[model samples]
Target: MHNNEILCRLLAAATLALGAAGAHAQGAAGSWFGGIGVTHIAPDVSSGNLSPPSAPGTQIDVDSDTQPTIFIGRMITDNWSVEVPIGLGFKQKIQGAGAIAGVGQIATVRTLPITVFAQYRFFEPTQRIRPYVMLGLTYTYNHDEQGSATLNAVNPINPPGGTQIDVENRFSLTPGLGVTAMINERWFVDAQYAKSFLKTKTTLNTGQTIEAKIDPNVFRLAVGMRF
Candidate 1:
């Protein structure tokens, strides 16, 4: 199956399992919560050498993308929980910078980020509003990479035509902070801000490689129901 389809199935199963577990738990600690939200992903992208000595010191920048997000959380304690964050999909634009500045868009790629967070909710458990902090790890899968004609004109090997580029899958540490406002007994609104410290390399079909640091900031707003 497609990766996105696989992700959807995995999340669906997790929700059912967590809900079942919550149904049998007498206390609030084991309760299950699930949410859907819109997330904005902004990348602080920087690169090193599109091609050393040839296109020497050519750097690139990745533009931002936004997508829908889904997450499920299990309350481990009155003040702590574990949550998994998943995306519908993301599309980013790669632009030339520094030595290759103003070359416009060089490529485009789609990404899926898989992340899990360990969160600490502050204040009294009975309060209607709570603020939280979380730390997690993420693995980003990149695919559907395509090159633009502008990039082809600059690349030595594919000077006459464009060729695709591939971005390697990578892992990073994610850290975030957010707040939850209780709407009723089992409903709430959540807003969060997170960042991933990620680095990866991209390889061109012509055998050239470039290293990139994509520390992306994420913003999310969601509505959830607790079981």
Candidate 2:
């Protein structure tokens, strides 16, 4: 089975168990909460051609990344809340694919995904375990794109004079589901899974472009405190 599938099952089972025997409290109305955790981003990339002046099937691939993150939120009502997630950035490796399979790495880029979610909690505030659904908007900013030596040597579209890449910023719609299990009156554990409907274009300094679908799956687990 896929790793993601396995994780889903594990989290679901844990949530069910917690619902029967867990500690006190909840994110009651007008309350504030915050947490620190780690997140994993896996991009399901659908690559595109490098536009004219390149190999017939020149394409690219993106790898996954993990980073530390923080979350802060306010419960507007007993069943409604808003949250913001923050992270330093995610560094991803860009590699050769399709017709240029052996070319190795093409470039590296760092990205920051900014998002805000409006969520609705399920079950009563006094419940030990609660499930939630959320909808969010994200703005992705990409920077520090540096091409590799392999890319320079295999500059299929242009002469090997050191090519630099720029990936355009994008906005995407995000949707998610999660479960929160209170450990005590002041602490809780939260697990969530979300997906972004995302796509972007990469432009080369040599005047070439490639559009790719980077619909990334985001997974998170956090330990938090309520006040």
Candidate 3:
């Protein structure tokens, strides 16, 4: 009799747990969500040899930056949603190495990544916690390319004091994974990680071109409300 009573109690607890989970799901379909957060972008940089191998051992280095980010999403179904990530501009510094090991910062480039993601969430929408995966395309726009006087001293192609580099815009594929946890019926917290496959070429006025693989890894944390 005791064993049967314990079994009944376990079943009752499970039923209550499931009921609570159902109460939270409310499904976000046809609803809009918005959030704000901070993002950190780390680039796995691999740069090509400087033009003509002027400095045979020369390579480039780029530093990571953190900026504010905004998230806007629309739920199409119980398990799917579309998201747009709006990121503030990231500043990158280019430095010289190898033969010019001590040249320090040679240039600065500002970039903005515009991307849209299609996400598939796991578990029922009413669950308090859900994990998701995403795939998307990112468009990187590079601008404000500036060269330091140190770089100009090395190459005088334009009869000027410094050399200017042009970075072309490119598109890349991005894949990501994340988790969302509900704090209440109207609010939630999110954490995500994503990576981009990107390769771009930088051309100097000196008629030299260098290829760089700026595969960036992105991390974000946010708090949002559902409507």
Candidate 4:
């Protein structure tokens, strides 16, 4: 009778251990997730020249603008994951009116950049909060507009002389850092920041050179869900 009781107790203990192991396995296997969110990109153009005549030595200050972003990710291990993010956005009203060396009344220029990126996440997985750093690559589409008067200053005004110039595509490097919070089994949120190291130059139809250095830095907040 004592031997029988001992055997029954051992069997019960084994079943409890198996149940606990199963629960842990389920949690780990289902941790993969994806999300969509919006971001704000603040691009600044400094140390360059634009023409208009607001004043001498007057600098153009561009403000921060909002952009929309989408992302999908998968947890490869307990502490590492990878994500791909697509960003579409615009920056308007980058106004700089200053007298040029020879060109009169520098024109106001506007630039818009659209980017897509892929990144890797490194962090320890946790139930509530996780912190990670990301490194990635981005493809950017850049559009720039300048006034006819400004273009005419460099060359005689023709039917196509003053038209807006658009450089549609470019590439750059993306690096970022952020933290993620798991609100529940299915919902999560994240806050992140990234920078783009790309350089672009514009040449007017009149043989004058306008160099635009686009080093974009971005801050983002997003909510996500796991499948």
- Which candidate has the top score in TM-score? 2
Q: After superposition, how far is residue 60 of candidate 2 from its true place, in Å?
A: 1.2
- In the order shown, the candidates' Cα RMSDs to the true structure are 8.9, 2.1, 10.5, 15.8
**How does each model score on lDDT?**
0.79, 0.87, 0.79, 0.54
In model 1, which runs have C-alpha deviations exceeding 4 angstroms?
1-27, 159-161
Error of 4 at 169 (Å): 2.9
Which residue pairs clash within candidate 3?
25-126
Which 10 consecutive residues of model 3 have the lowest summed lDDT?
1-10
Residue 127, model 3: Cα distance from true site in angstroms: 0.9
For each candidate in turn, the TM-score is 0.85, 0.93, 0.85, 0.65
For residue 13, model 2's alpha carbon misses the true position, in angstroms, by 8.4
Clashing pairs in 4: 51-105, 51-106, 51-107, 52-105, 52-106
Off by over 4 Å in 4: 1-32, 50-63, 97-123, 143-163
Write candidate 3's Cα lDDT for 1-227 as tens digits.
23235334433433443343324553467887878877778888888877763657666777788898999999999889999998768999888866777788878899999999999999988788788899989999999999888777655354454689899999999998877776668777677778899998988878877888989888777777788
Q: Which stretches of candidate 3 lie over 4 Å from their true place?
A: 1-23, 154-158
Local error of candidate 1 at residue 46 (angstroms)? 2.3
The positional error of residue 7 in candidate 4, measured at the CA in angstroms, is: 61
